[model samples]
Target: MRTIQLKKILNEHCIQFIEKKQMDLSLSIEDANSSLHSASNSTAGDKHDTSRAMMHLEIEKKSKQLNEVVQLKKLIPILIDNSQQKSFGVGTVVETNAGSFYMSFNAGKKEIEGQSFTFISLASPLAQAFKNNLNKKEFQFMQKTYTILKTF
Candidate 1:
């Protein structure tokens, strides 16, 4: 598949994943807040206090996750620039002996048009190795050498 097409697919998948995660986190936060409010009005002393505290913790956790999702959403477009480059960089789709990779985000395995591609962040170990050895025909990571089949 073409790099632009692959990038588009990965972008859509990443956005969908982050949005879905945000929705779930929002729901959890709402539920936790509701429980906390209810607990505040309860007559049960110790149990009510404990329940409210736990709900507060839960809200904090879910709020943190929601913040992360929002950050990820902001990061999506920065990596999708379709600049032309001979070597690997952000927005490039790489095919190697090891596997196909989209140097965009850590969205894991994505299958497009019958081909499997791993969506990885540019800061990933493998991508860092590739960065250091730009234009090299092959490179080794963890004792395994991967031939640079193509990059676009």
Candidate 2:
């Protein structure tokens, strides 16, 4: 497949993942809210207090996670701009002797069109190593030398 097509596919996948995360987090938050409500109605004093506290904490944590997902959702569109892919940076697909990677965000490994591409974040150590070897087409990680096959 063409690099841009694959990139677009990966971008779509990222969006899907983000949407699923948002939905899941929202559901968890709702569940915690319901639990908090139930806990508030309980007659047991100390036990009710502890359950309410736990539910509040859970809601707070889920809200923070949802906010992070929102921020990540905002990043997806900006990061997927169809500019030239020339270097080891975001919005580029890099293939190395070790494996193929799509440098966007750490979406983990995905099998698309029967090929495995590890979606990685630019801030990742592997991406940093790739950037350091951009010109050389080779890098060393974990004591094993890997060569850059292509970038798109």
> lDDT for each of the candidates?
0.79, 0.82
lDDT per residue, candidate 1, 67-149, as tens digits? 98898888767665543444567777778888888777787787888878888888999888877766786888889998878
Query: How well does candidate 1 score on lDDT at residue 106?
Result: 82
Question: Estimated TM-score per prediction?
Answer: 0.83, 0.91
Per-residue accuracy of model 2 over 1-152 as CA lDDT, tens digit each: 87667788888888888899999999999988988887787797887788888889889999999999998888786667742556557787788888788877777788988878898888999888888888999767889998999888
Q: Which segments of candidate 1 are over 4 A away from where they belong?
A: 83-87
Considering every candidate listed, which one attains the maximal lDDT?
2
Worst 10 residues of 2 by lDDT: 81-90
What local lDDT score does residue 80 receive in model 2, on the 0 to 100 scale?
Answer: 79
- Alpha-carbon RMSD, each predicted model: 2.2, 1.6
Q: Candidate 2: which stretches are off by over 4 Å?
A: none
